[model samples]
Target: MNLEILTPERKLYNGEVYGVQLPGVDGLFEVLEKHAPMVSALKAGKLKVLKDKSMSDTTSYAIQGGFVEVFHNKVTVLVEGAVPAEAGR
Candidate 1:
């Protein structure tokens, strides 16, 4: 699926991804290829980017609240701000 992470100041990431783990207001949820269409509220937490199914090329960011929309094999994340997570392992 194609994913784009955007903030008011700039775009963080824009490319193809295997999936993404989002910090939903209720908890955490994941969006994958061919996933159903929907939108959700996000909270301050880590956004995990799965670069591939092997989970070998993963990246993470700390986001300060946002909203996510999924449609047509694309995921768009609009957040207040985001920074690369130094503690990603």
Candidate 2:
């Protein structure tokens, strides 16, 4: 699936991912390729994405709060703040 992480400052990630875990406002949910379409409100927590081609390696971001949209085989995350891999998991 296509995934993009966006922050108030900039777009953090834009690529294909095999899986994604979101910190939903109500709870956490996972998304995979061709999964059901949906939109979710987020909580202050982490967003983890395992690159589409690999499962062991992962990328995590500390997000203040955000929303995730899943559609057309793509996922877009809009957040107030986000921390990328270089910043630590």
Candidate 3:
């Protein structure tokens, strides 16, 4: 699946990913390749990107809050603010 994480100031990531773990308002949820179309609200937390099936190659970000839309094998995340998790250390 293709994933894009965007903020008002910039685009954080844009590329193909195996799956992604999001901080849904209700809790954590994951979107994978060929997922059903839907939209959801997100909370302030970590967003994990699964770069591949092995889950070894991955990345994470700390997002303030946002909305996510899944459609046609694409995942779009619009957040108020975000930064790579490691950057926060």
Q: Which candidate has the highest TM-score of all? A: 1
lDDT of 2 by residue, 1-89 (tens): 89999888888999988989999998888988898889889999878998855667788988888799999889999999987645445
Question: All models: lDDT?
Answer: 0.96, 0.87, 0.95
Clashes of each: 0, 1, 0
The positional error of residue 27 in candidate 3, measured at the CA in angstroms, is 0.4
Runs in model 3 lying further than 4 Å from the true structure: 87-89
Best by lDDT: 1
RMSD to native for every prediction?
0.9, 2.0, 1.8
Report the Cα lDDT for residue 41, model 1: 96
What is the Cα-based lDDT of residue 67 in candidate 2?
90
| TM-score for all models, in order of appearance | 0.97, 0.89, 0.95
Model 3 C-alpha lDDT per residue in residues 1-89, reported as the tens digit of each score: 99999999999999999999999999999999999999999999999999999988889999999899999999999999998899332
Error of 3 at 50 (Å): 0.3
Backbone clash tally (model 2): 1
